[model samples]
Target: MTNRIERLNELDSYGVLNHKQDEELNDLAKIASLALNVPIAQITFVHDEFTFVKANIDVVSTESIPGRVKRRESFCHHSIKNPKETMIVNDASKDSRFINNPFVNSDPHIRFYAGKPLTTPAGNPLGTICVIDNKPRNLSLGEKQLLDILSKKIMAYLNNKRKLLNQENKIIDDALRLQNLTDRLPVGIFQLDKSNQNNLRFKFLNKTMKEMCPSVNTNKSSESIEILFSSIYPDDKNRFINHLNESFDNLSFSNIQFRIKKGNNCAWFAMKGNVERRTDGSKTFYASIRNIDNQIEYEKTLEQIAFDISHVLRRPVSSLSGLVNLVDTKEKLNKKELLEYIGLVKTVSTEMESYTRKLNDIYQKKKEIITNHNKSYT
Candidate 1:
């Protein structure tokens, strides 16, 4: 017995068992029947439980079953067992192996049965290309040779078809995988037309990017560009436009960060891009946009802290230093001077403590905000 799993897999590799790919095979079957002078001819594929007929010529079909048959009942089943040669029964009624077969004894009443297995290059048998006749007959040497040649032609056609189908499947798989991978990224990725300064047409936008700029429309390039430029915070608008236009002209890009006005709120976005110019002088800009709002807010908090330390803490720190210097210089200070200096020292310490507390509070709030922002992305 053949390795049933490998045989089934070999049959599946053809990719024609489930659908109708028999237009060419049907023509081939017709050619076989005409050349062999048989009442019926078919190309079949056998799986685990059923024998599927891909192409047939003049085979009778009942409404209940169509052109398929149980695997055990098919003449092609027996034909598949011997992959390298034909199984020809010139007279089925007199043959011991098939005398009680339903197809042999009833319906098509196959008295003459000749089948050549449809085998793969790996010696796995799929099914058969066979001829059937109601009367007993013998095939001449020339007729047998013709059948061999036709079977080879059928296999050649099927192999070529499988190659094309696999190639198409590969392309579709690659595209879907790339799309899924890009959609899951944290940054928004896109492609835009860079043929001219006025055109801002988007050629492609990943899912993240589509959600990022919901207001931008692909169909209206110039209008969309206007909207984007208008949305930019006025301070950075001109600089952003200049850099983008220069990048388009130079076919190189540098990083830039700007704020985009989103409703009443704004977001800080950092953009990095590269330009691809095709040989046809057409150009496309591929870019990634990352939301850096948290980073911007954190930086602002740090700057505020620096400003406070420079302005608010400087006065008390300088006052404390001067008080210490004054005490050090006067070795014979009077009681009243000692008392005043002590009071001044206490007041400066109190002011320093208050400022330190305020700074701590500011740091704590900013730290919590940044921590929460980072957690959301993870």
Candidate 2:
């Protein structure tokens, strides 16, 4: 009895018994009952103590009636033990094993039984396809063969359904992963779908995109691209349009810095994106917008500082250099007199000019560094 329990658990682990009800199994049950001319036909997973009905024909109970017989008293328990062989009881009342069985002696008496075991793809018996009758009857060889064929069909249907369910679960998992990644991305991402020759709609926008341009959520009826262009400064509109058109034509990435007006205030944004040609002769544009106003201002300030150093300090440095040459080349009347003159001129020109040139070089190098940093924005 313990061995029977272990075997039943093993069969249950195959998951065939866990399947959902479908039209295919119902159709098979109907056909089997009609062909066998039986009042009841069932696709059942037989366990140690009970049978689980997967599909049934003309059975009042959708599930098996509990305790119709004990585990040791069931013929299904004996049949599943030799899964490769079918079990047929032509006369249960005459069979010694079933003559005194509770099911045969009392209500819902059973006298005829035929069962073919249903096996998994790996050839383990999971359950049975069975037909039952109240009176003793025998099945012809042809009928037995037909039952075997239907059992095989049931196995094939179960396998196909398992595969489809697994595939759907995988698809759902992948979609969830992608959605999480998109939402947590650092950059502000947006998608524009071309609705027509002149209209583009916002198909999607991530959280960061909405925060960067609050007005982007406005003008719900207007197309996304049109609204974006309308926000651009009038002076930069042509250049922005030209760059966008060029990017589409070449099917390449584009980077453009333009000023956009939000209400009465204006700021600069660096827009970068790619144009993708879809299969339906339409286009999709994906882009990220970064606010670059502060960076641009910092770069301009550095440039101005460099210009001031070069122009304001060059003349003084040159004049000091000439004065230093004069002092170095002139013959000295006396050591003391020459030293005094040199000290006076050096203090007035040479030292001052040298310090100015050094300051100028420092400012110029700072400007170069700033420019290099700003270039990485796009």
Candidate 3:
């Protein structure tokens, strides 16, 4: 049990104690009032100096009743002292504890009283389900039992309502966080529901997607995916579709490079996605689109450079090998002539080794550059 003053102050802090109305609470009060045949049944909260009715079944003129009344002056306050239990006073005037109370003896008297305390999740009492009457009357055991059951129902309703509110708030918070992340991403992100008649639609599109395809409005429902694919290069469109189908059918990640016509220019794009099959024999995919035109062009240029180096080195290497073979196979000659031929063979061998080293270095560097670029795009 909490100190009466402390409990009253805690009730005030709930904010629902005063000027808050709920239709559900009012319905509960009405049911309790009818079951007990009481003119006044209320969900009340006790503040520092007063008991405020949060929900009432009947019209009551008075408000802010004194909370710190003496034991002999307040039946409602005494009833809520033990929050864990219900207090049923069949006749307040007949009860020895509240018979001499000033409120009962004077005007706006309380004769019949019954109250069940309301507590929070932490077991702190906030208010009560109370019934009062101007005339003294005894209630049956059945009526008391019904009032107790109604109080428990009211508590359950409040608990469930609070849980629902918390869940709703969490959902809203998660949505905002997801939106923030999507907006900041540099690549185009989208989801496709392949379940709908082999048609791919964008379930999500990031800010980058809007910027990349300014003419493709995602907000419209009639935007056909086929129309989008039609913009792709004729030679690459079938291959791109084939790759996408294979990935989805095999439940593997798909990586595709294709060219699309953007205005008068042709641009290349790299797409990566994962396929997911639902329980209902339907599939979906999530993908990221990236502009890889510059990367592809750079790769082509590197390949051409490697080819040119190989072409230039091929003639020199062949000539050097022929000269070495001829020098080794020739008949005996003068000492000076033989010595000069040997020196010429050594010079050609050295030149061939240098060209080979340069070729290997270029090949290794090109591989490294391509690997790094692929990693970045992925």
Q: Identify the candidate with maximal lDDT.
A: 1
What are the root-mean-square deviations of the candidates from the true structure over C-alphas?
5.3, 7.4, 7.6
Candidate 1 clash pair list: none
Clashing pairs in 2: none
Candidates 1 and 3: which is better by TM-score? 1
TM-score, model 2 to reference: 0.59
The local distance difference test score of model 3 is: 0.73
Per-model TM-score versus the true fold = 0.73, 0.59, 0.58
Better of 1 and 2 by lDDT: 1
TM-score of model 3 vs. true structure: 0.58
Ranking according to TM-score, highest score first: 1, 2, 3
Task: Give the poorly placed runs of model 1, Cα more than 4 Å off.
Answer: 22-41, 57-73, 91-111, 132-136, 149-180, 191-207, 210-249, 258-264, 279-281, 321-343, 376-378
lDDT of 1 by residue, 1-378 (tens): 679888888788889777665688889888889999887888888889899988878745342234679988888888888888888999999998888888876777888988888777888888888988889998888888888888889889989988999999999999889878988998877777755445576766667664555565534433445645766777889999899888888888758998877677677889999987878677888899888978997899989998999998999999999998888998798999989998999999999999999899989998999889766644
C-alpha lDDT of residue 201 in model 3: 68
Whole-model Cα lDDT of every candidate shown, in order: 0.81, 0.73, 0.73
- Candidate 2 lDDT over 1-378, as tens digits, reads 125555566665546555567677778978888998987777777765666677767653334434233556666766666677789999899999898887677645778889888876665676788887878998999899988999999988877766786788789998678656765765567787764474678777665555556556622523366666777888998999889878877778989899887668777889899989988777778898877865787777778767866886666666767777877787755888778766776676765677678777876776687666456433
